[model samples]
Every structure is written in structure tokens, then in C-alpha cells.
Target: MTEPGDPRFGATHRRFVIPTVISRATIGGSTCQIVVGVLSSGSATQRSQRGELRAELLRIALRGQGLADPCTVGVEHDANGAPALSSPHIGSVSFSYDGIWAVVAISPSEGRIGVDIQMPRRVSPTVLRRFAPDLATRADDKSTYSEFARRWAAREAASKAAGTGLRGELLRTVLPVARAGRDFGATYTVLDGWTFPALSLAHKD
Candidate 1:
């Protein structure tokens, strides 16, 4: 678990093999930074409060980046259901929560961005077959539940960035690359003492 200000925080693992913490990415020459935070007590018990912590963290991130006060920032869903920031300089804000942890990604430039964080758990074969058949095919002999969760996290994160949110065929979507034994290009990692698959994307037009 690394603190927000630690040197290693907000670094990108871009090797396409392993997960990263507080990771970052570049799109169209602009950089997007992701900040990870623990879920709030209210968020843990109340389903409605799930996004509160992430949103607040986003506000903090924005402010630190020299944006307006978090209270003044607006988070609204697009026609496609992707989250966007109201501020002009800060292009987009995306968040993901998995009951235990929350992550917020902010694009410093004009690119769109999204993020997702998921706690690794046992995934049943049936669920895998429905959501990710490819993973199902190889998971048994070559992959573990953790790997499945990591790949799922990548898909979810990419979906969020695309502003589609699993509306399309999971297999047809852009599958995030994860090397068999190394980390690269949007892999997952741990942050703030939480072991989870965290992903971020910064896309340019």
C-alpha cells in the first residue's frame, strides 16, 4: 500500500503483463493520472453511497491539479452513460468501486478517461462462460481465479473508458493486454493497502 504522495504512486506499469497501483497513462501526448483511495464507511454499508468516496477523491485530485474546488466540480453522465467532469481544463473523470476500495481517474488534457477497481474473488465457470468465454477456455488449465479477475478488470476499465459499459459483446471489445508473466499496458496493481485489479485509460480523439 503506497501513500498518495509516494514516489511510486501514480506510476504506469505499461508492460502489458502485471497490474499497477495509482497508475497513469498517456493519450495523444496528454497524461492522465489515477488516484486510489479506500472506500468510506458510508459507502460500504449503503449501496447508494458507493460512488461518493470516488467522487470526492476525484475532486481532491482535481484540486491538486489546480482545478476548482471539489464541491464546485460537477460529475454528470453522458448520453452514453460515461462520467464527465464539468470543468473545461479537466476533460473527464471516471470512477470504479468494488465495495472495499475506490479509484478515480482524471485526464489532465482533453482526452477521455475511465477507471475500474475490483477485488479478486472466486469466479464460477458459468459466470466466466457468459462474461468472458475466452478466459473460461484457458482459465482451467493455465490461469487462476486471480488472473481471470485481472483480465475482467481490464475489460471493465476499457468499457468504462469507451463509455459503453458492457453494452456490447465482451469478446468483441478491446481486450486489455496482460502478459503471461509480466505486467504491461493497463495491467492491475495494489494501492493503499488494498489488493485489487485497478485499471485506467486515457483515450484521444
Candidate 2:
């Protein structure tokens, strides 16, 4: 709903929904915020065109923060592979793009942030068992898919924010359900009341 950018995703006349959220804070007299943008792909064609959508969203987000020449801002990776902004002011950036959708999170101050977005889809029981056997042991119901997706998203987003990627125990870790309050700036939203799979944004000091 926020003005990130718009590109029609093909889906038999159906409109793909893109939602953006900005969370703000202040650190050492500098304003800090994380902008999260999600793009829903309705068809294969639109999914393939996500690259442009991502870049445009990034540009818009930067410009909205009064950054100059956002389109030309360079993005680099640290030794741990977390993304960093080459320009000053903006601190760190992280994004994740599933085949069907994507989410980008940008931080405007000092700290690391990560984001992950996913469109709801069926998950094979076998696959779920491998990554999260604890979830597999639970009963099957309508909430099963949503819970699974959120747990996955939370784990991945946290991993990325930690700049550790998915290594060691994190690779197969299961995260707790998102709660209203948490430390380390951990927050997540499942848009449309779980109509969409999941969107998670977190930061590490």
C-alpha cells in the first residue's frame, strides 16, 4: 500500500498486492528505520520480473529518506555476507526473495537488519519434517501451513540479521511464534491476517 513502486504482476486480470511498512527509531542522535516492502507475484511472468521491482523499491525507499541519487547507491557485502550501504547515513540492508514473492528491509542507522517474505503455499510433509520435525509431529489443520511458514521466515530473518546466514544449528532451527513484544528489535507481521504467508524484520546490535 505504501509508495515503493508498482509493476503489474500478470494473473488473469487479478491485481497483485504490494505492501510496505516502515519502522523507526533513533540511535545516537540519528534517525533509524527499516522499510519493508513486499511484492506478490500472481503468475510466472511477473515472478520472473522481480529483479526490476526489487531495484525500484530500493531506490524509492532510499529517496524517501532524502538520500541522494538512490538509484546509484552501491551495495556491498561484509565478510559475513550481510549487505552494507556504500554511502553514508544509511547503515545496513537485507532482503530475501522467494520464487513467488520478495521482501526488502533497509536500515537508516547504525545496526544490522534482515527481512524475509513468503507467499503461502503447500508444504510437503516430508520436506517439513526434515527442517522442522517438531512441526511435523503436530496435528494437521488449516493453521499448519501458516505456522510453518512463519517459523521458517522468523528463523531465516533472524539468521540474516545476525549476519550468520543459515549455518550450524540455525540451518535447521525452529523459531518461536512472533509475539507482541521482544528485544533486539525483533518484529514480524503476517499481512492480511495470514492471508499472505509471512513477513519478518529484525535487527541485531
Candidate 3:
């Protein structure tokens, strides 16, 4: 039987995998590429398997950018557990996964970029108030869950790009607006039926 890391046991062996270029958008001076795929189920060690899947996708993303040896690229995480390329800096990357879907965002420039995927779900008023008061104020009984998902994704992406990871007052302060200078800015788009909020931090001289 094939082990976990074997190419035959994971996404590499899947025939219906999505392409590396799901969508591309220009943020500031950086062009961010979004890559997405669906995860296979039935793994006894789901967490480790998912991590390996994500790493494989990152390698594919790096390879698309013309990296000489994508397999040698290493992913390092900050204190907040936000991932970055270890050395020979090709670009900045951020990713998120929900259910069976996973997505990766790559910025082929000095600017940092983040991406998040959120699925629509029931959110209570109190939970909304605590997490996203600005959105709560406009919330009504008829509110669509997709709106909340998008808002959550936007904030999460902003925090990831800022290297803060939703800590402290980040969720409240990081709005979907572009700040004056050297701040994280976010934009929302739908790729492969997933709503993603892509973030980019302007490079400071």
C-alpha cells in the first residue's frame, strides 16, 4: 500500500484536479495568482493530509511563476502561524481551506498577499456583534449569510496580510477599505464558485 507522502496517494494522483490559475488580479504593483482545488476525503489523518495537500498546491503555484525547483521551496510560518516562503524569495503567499475546497494566493512581487475562503452559514446576532459590529449594525432578519461570509473572509485576509492573524482589535480595524500608506487593503472576488477576499500590503521603502 502507498503511504501518505506518496504521489499516488494525494492530489497529484487525482484526475479531476483544478488548474493552478483559477484567477489572477493586480493589487498595487503586484499581480496575485489564486489557485484552488478540491480535497479528497476518507483520510484517517485528515489534518496532516490536508497540510500536505496545501503544500503541494503551493509548489504548483510557485512552479507556475517559473521557479527553477519548486520542490525545494520551503514554507515558514511566523509566530502567528502565517506562512511565507523561507528563502530565495519568490513572492508572498497566503491560503485558506473550507470543507472540501482549498485555495492559495500568490503575489509575485515584494508586496505581501493573503487570501481567505469562507462559506455561508448561520451567524447569531450576538456573535456578529462581537466579531463584526460594523456589519451587525446593518444586519436584519433577512440578511444573507453570504454577506457575513464575505465580511469574515475580508477581515481574515487583511489580518493574514498584516501578519497579525485576527489578534487584538484587528478584526474591527481592518475594514475593506484601502488605508492611506503601507497598510493592508482588501478586495473581494468569486473564483470557481468560491468567494475570496484577497489582500495586499503595500511595500514600504
Candidate 4:
């Protein structure tokens, strides 16, 4: 397995592809970059089509991992509005999307895996204040958006790796990651009998 700081996942696999409206897409190595996309239908922002796309994407991604046959992936909503996979066969996976950029991951019994990706968005003082309230104060910095996207992806990836959504399951759980760097995980919120590895996924395309 590649170490967290391994140069492979960062400097290579600069670009990737995802099916039209897939649950997510991940294409990056240990030292490369990852790309993700979501498929949706209807006028709703979080279209249900994304759920379908995510499932298919999951199967495709896990095909070589030995857990693709009985593949059964679907979107499930938790109390905190966090999305999770509904499959007993899936040990762990990550899901993230930023309109044009989306990504997800499937974990194997003997390897580290997690991914996240987001697209760039228009920023303004008032809009950023409400839309991305978390980073409103840091809008002046050019890397603020990237930082927000990375942190969001990191938290979601870490949570997915832990198999728990926001709803207090990730309560008191905080992920440490670079606002604009690769290999975001070195440690995670360790639980009683669960410990998560530091997985990384970032993109710009």
C-alpha cells in the first residue's frame, strides 16, 4: 500500500472520467489526483438520478476489488442529511460531488481507500456568507474555496471510511487535512473498536 505522503497519488493520474450522472467517479493514484461526478434527474439539486449513478459507479470501481458481483449500492439518508451506502457487503466507501466534479470510493478488506472531489464555484461576500458560511471569513484568501472543498471532502471521506454519517455518529469527530494539498489523512477520529486510515482524494477538472 502507498503511504499517505507517497508521491504517486499526487503527481500522476491528473485526469479521470465518470459515466454521465454516476454516483461518483475516482481516478487517481497514491500520488495522483482523483475526479468524481454525479448523475441526477429532474430539477431538484440533489437529484435521485445521482443515487443510481452512484450505485453503478460503485460496481465499476469495485469490479477489480472482488466485491463487485453482489454489488448492491443505494443512497440512504441519515438524520443529519448525510448520504450513506446501503449494503452489508460494502465495508467502506466515500462519496462527494461539486456539480461538474464528483467522486466516490469502495474499500477492500486489505487496502486503504477513500476519495472526494469538488468543482470551483463563484464566490462573493454575501453569497459565500450564506452558501459556504464555514469559510465566509476566509474569502479574501485565493485558496479559501479549495480549502473549503478539501476540508468538506476530507470530512466526508473520513466519515465514509468510518461507515458513519453526520448524525452525531461523526459528532466530536474532526478530520485534519490540507486546505490545498494531497494525502489529507494521517489519522482519524478513532472509535472504541474502529480506527480509520488517512486516505486522500483531491481534484481540479
Q: Highest TM-score, which number?
A: 3
TM-score of each: 0.68, 0.69, 0.72, 0.47
Please give the CA lDDT of all the candidate structures. 0.55, 0.58, 0.59, 0.42
Off by over 4 Å in 3: 1-11, 15-21, 43-45, 130-143, 171-193, 196-205
Number of residue pairs clashing in candidate 1, backbone atoms closer than 3 angstroms, sequence gap of 3 or more or interchain: 17
Error of 4 at 68 (Å): 6.3
TM-score of candidate 3 relative to the true fold: 0.72
Residue runs of model 2 more than 4 Å from their true location after superposition: 1-48, 126-134, 137-139, 180-195
Candidate 3: deviation at residue 177, Å? Answer: 8.2
lDDT leader: 3
Off by over 4 Å in 1: 1-4, 7-24, 40-43, 47-51, 129-143, 171-195, 200-204
The segments of candidate 4 whose C-alpha lies over 4 angstroms from its true place after superposition are 1-35, 38-46, 67-90, 110-115, 122-138, 167-205
Ten consecutive residues with minimal summed lDDT in candidate 2?
8-17
Each model's Cα RMSD? 8.0, 5.8, 7.4, 10.4
> Looking at model 1, which ten-residue stretch has the lowest summed lDDT?
11-20
User: Per-residue alpha-carbon lDDT of model 4 for 1-205, expressed as tens digits?
Assistant: 2222111222112233333221222323322222233333331254555555455455555543455464555656667554445763444445665554445555432223445554444457675564456677878776765554445556655444444444463444443434323322322221111111122443221
